[model samples]
Target: MGYYQIDCFKIHLTILRILGVWPTENPSPCYIYLSGLFVFIFTVLYVVIYTMNFYFLPQQLEIFAEELIFYFTNVGALSKALAFIFLRDKVKKMLEMLESDMFQSDNPEEIKLIQKAKEKSSFYWKITAGLSVSANTVNVFLPFVVHVVFNVKLEFPVCRYSFIPEQYEAIFLYPAYLYQSIGITSHMLYNVNIDTFLLGVMFLAMAQLDILDRKLRKVTDVCVHTNAPSGSIDKMIDDENAVAEIIKCIKHYDAVSEYCKLIQEAFSEILFVLFSSGSCKICMCLFRFTMPAETKYFVFLTLYTVVMTLQVMVPCWFGSRLIEKSSQITFSVYDCDWTPRCRRFKSNLRLLVERANRPITIRGGKMFLLSLATFTAIMNSSYSFFTLLRHMQSR
Candidate 1:
């Protein structure tokens, strides 16, 4: 019986693998899945939230905005505090090293210092990497929690009678609202996490730059002062076999920094979009309470189109600019002077630049997908809203 049970287990494992039910070795595929989920959630949330603000308590939009602000601010503070505790010492050391004299050779003493700095920097960023993972995990689960907790409802009866009201068609809206609220909340939280991760990545690149700059300055000083044999710096510089490596490192630093800046710009732009949307929601609420129902829905539809378009188009626009910058960098590197000794280095630099400029196919590709999703969701939701309003009008 035991032998049979073991054989059954092996069979089950084989079946799972054959069916592609086993966990993937690569995490990129996993992240791509998450990103898809994220985009879907955001689209749904925009529809739900905007519709609720328009169709329901349009006057309470300001209050909702305030609540959102509090939630995002708290999350940001928590993430920043966690990052500081993990990275304080490493950040201080990197800053100190950057401030120090640049002619430090790869002597035993300098090597020890670089090793320590690198270790500390790595430790700090590892914390951020963990937080990035954690934040998304929390976002994934929070919607389920909120759905259970809020028991949010969007449908309430409006008086349908001319003399005495009859029940108009009941539209169930709370589930949609719940999903929207959760999606927006998750997005805000995710932005905070992205900002923290960008900071950590930038610091890591800075640490690498500091170490390399110090080593290069030391080599230049030595070459000036002493008639050293060829490949002298190769012995002294850690992994300094060719100029290609240095260019590669520099290119990597540029990539990291550029990504960080893009995140920053994207964050700010998204926030502006959210703020404007929120404000419009508040205005719609005020108008609805005081104005007619039909008029309120009209304004809501207009605002929805504007907000959704901005969200989709702004990112696509920025991503296009990034592709342009990356392309320019390719030519910039190719134009650099190459010494005979730096031939391998030049080739490597060219390779790095080419990779950076390769049209940003994968990451930038998502923008188009995002645009499609946004457009479809907005058009569909608007149609549904208008259809319902028309039905109410006919009755």
Candidate 2:
């Protein structure tokens, strides 16, 4: 799992280097100096170009609307880049803690569970990365394809910017295309990297909850005896072992709780920004889809909308799983044969049940819980915004 994570991080760094925004694990004086200069130049160019297209362009409503969607999308990507830069230490700490806390158990069942989690996480990461790359490739090449097939010259660059002088258009046309291609690809990769990394973290939390559930069930099974021997000596020894097992389970549960807290702290801000921007992106994409556009443009919008929906759904799905698994602990305790246990043992069980009753949750900036419910709310809000936009345009 560590190797896989490192490989993914390397891919992220490669993309950043291509964008001239390299972020090394160990920052030397030279690295810092160079990285700062690169980030400043890249960010300034991105913001100025997109901002001009969005706010200053003298274009039709349809054209401006399309540029607005791209503007917000790029803003989201920039937000991710800024977050990666500022929260590098926190992200590093979270990854270290995840490695140390999980995969430490010697129990065969626990080890198996962890392995399954790693496999699942890797699968998800690969699928998302593939989809992002494919979509970006299509977006980059579609303009050229349309231009060639239809033999119609585009009035503006593919991204519809207004800052370039008309006198320089012939000279800078191909150069501008190359620049936009690199800029758009970098934005897509950066956004996907941060989003999928957060998803991996959420999956880790879900895996920890799974381990805790299994451990609790096993402890309950071992400690709860349906039948007892008549001799006091034998029963006393049995009770002592049961108590020891329960104590061990208690420690394991505590560890899982602490791990969940660490995850929440590490990702709350990122999640908040993702969910917030994701809502607007979805709404805008849907609105653009409704508006009459070129065939290729419509296809791109459709794919973009699907990706945005998936981004929101993946986290909510894992978050909902976390809640379900955490809640199961109390029920597992209840399933144990607690009728014949001693008074002290029952009291301990009761306390464990109480603790487990508090369902674990992942929050967005400490604001709202991330769950299927939240996903539903985002969809509803997006539809409402889309309706309002349509009505205003009609008027």
TM-score of each: 0.32, 0.86
The sequence of per-residue lDDT tens digits that candidate 1 reaches over residues 1-395 is 12211121233223222222222345377654664455444534343334344333335433343233223333333333333333434433433333333323346655564455445444544564465446444534454566568964322111111221235323324444345445444444443333333333334333344444343333223223133455667433422444534564565545444533443333333333333343333333333333244765556445544543443444444334434544454554443333333345555665665555554311322232222344354445445544554555459
TM-score of 2: 0.86
- Candidate 2 backbone collisions, by pair: none
Write the residue-wise lDDT of candidate 2 on 199-271 in tens digits.
Answer: 6666666666677677656654664344666457656666776666667667667767776776677677767
Which candidate gets the maximum TM-score versus the true structure?
2
Q: Judge candidate 2 at residue 395 and give its lDDT.
A: 98
Clashes of each: 5, 0
Q: What are the Cα lDDT values of the candidates?
A: 0.40, 0.72
Model 2 vs truth, CA RMSD: 3.5
Best by lDDT: 2
